[model samples]
Target: MRAFLPLIALATPLALGACGDPAPTYIDQAWIRLSPNKDTPSAGYFVAHGGDAATRLRGVLTDYALKVEMHESMSEGSGKGAMMTMKPLDSVDIPAKSTVAFAPGGKHLMLWGVNDTAISRGKMTLTFLLANGDRLLVDAIIQKPGADAPAPKADEHKDH
Candidate 1:
């Protein structure tokens, strides 16, 4: 066993190092679509990538907007008669090594009264609060409403 002592020491450190660190959660492709009507709330979308361990998205906060809330759209009925409804979400589950998208016609952020400073800068910083007590600050591109803007989908409405 004496001859194997040095080999064991070398292998032990490598094994411990491999198990020491886990991937961290992160957000990307964040953007917000401005509302033509000032009274209407603008919508925000992003993709959240889960870390090595599972966690929950508690909430999102931003200083640039007067209010920010997490919401999801759902269809109450089927076919042409289907009605789209939105409900506020307190938290969203994020599984390990998974990706959750906040896209149009699905989960999204509602922002009211976005400050002109952010609109002028064409970008804004949003804070993501996770259940693991990790607060991630991410920048989101701002898309202004204009002729060149992408047309809204049938399911996407201005009611929110």
Candidate 2:
């Protein structure tokens, strides 16, 4: 019985560790680049960290913006003939233990008619919907047009 007690103690910790929560899936470094033109939709970017299980980024929602859509930029041709094109994406897959970036020239969010309140606050809350039934709320820093804006890239706002 004493020997069995030692075995049970060792097994207890292993069982607890196995039952621990899975690695967390989350989003961070979120920001929005306001367009130089009010009529043009602004762009949003962020980085998503995958958890123990694979999932998909279904969409983003924000009360500050009238509309939000996920988009991807692609080059259709090669070399000098290369032309950039943008397409809306319904969902983006995120592999387990991986990172996905929504950057200036890659996947991004287009926001139209951002409310004045959010602009004044210089930040806004965004809700990220994941296929794994996770809703992550993150605050995105807002960058208004001018010198502090992100570096200008030809493909960044071609669609807007």
Candidate 3:
């Protein structure tokens, strides 16, 4: 009974795994919330995945602003409410089987001159320039600061 149980456990997994499952497709169109500030530029965050091999981000650009720069946020000062300073990043790399997270109060995309229009319901296209010169376009949805907005549904995104 003991030997039979071990074989069942191992064989079950192997048999199920042999169903010819395709490799996972890389996740695209990831994002981060854009926190608001009176004196600072707006930031956009997201994750860039490198599915099978290493990837490097050379730059990012968007028509919504004069320039798009990669920046990292660092916490300084004392106490629990330590002030954070966002510093510019030269470049970013996503190693093989890895991802680069762009989140609030962390490494984010710095957008300058956000335009006069409201961000509550507008679409912005962010072009990510990779080290290999491959540019990926992701449509970023804008929302009000402090409002919790869930991710878009699958039906909203269909291959055209």
Estimate the TM-score of every prediction. 0.84, 0.84, 0.66
Candidate 2 steric clashes: 0
How close is each model in CA RMSD to the real structure? 7.3, 7.3, 8.4
Model 3: ten consecutive residues of lowest lDDT: 21-30
The residue ranges of model 3 lying beyond 4 angstroms of the native Cα positions read 1-39, 76-83, 116-121, 152-160
Query: What is candidate 2's TM-score against the reference?
Result: 0.84
Q: Which whole-number lDDT from 0 to 100 does residue 150 have in model 1?
A: 42
Clashes of each: 0, 0, 1
Alpha-carbon lDDT of model 3 = 0.68
Query: For model 2, what is the error of residue 157's alpha carbon versus the real structure, in angstroms, after optimal superposition?
Result: 30
TM-score of 1: 0.84
lDDT of 3 by residue, 1-160 (tens): 8879988998998899888543321335444355477456666777676645576888888776666789998989889988988778889877776667787767888776665453544657778887766778877766556766546467543331
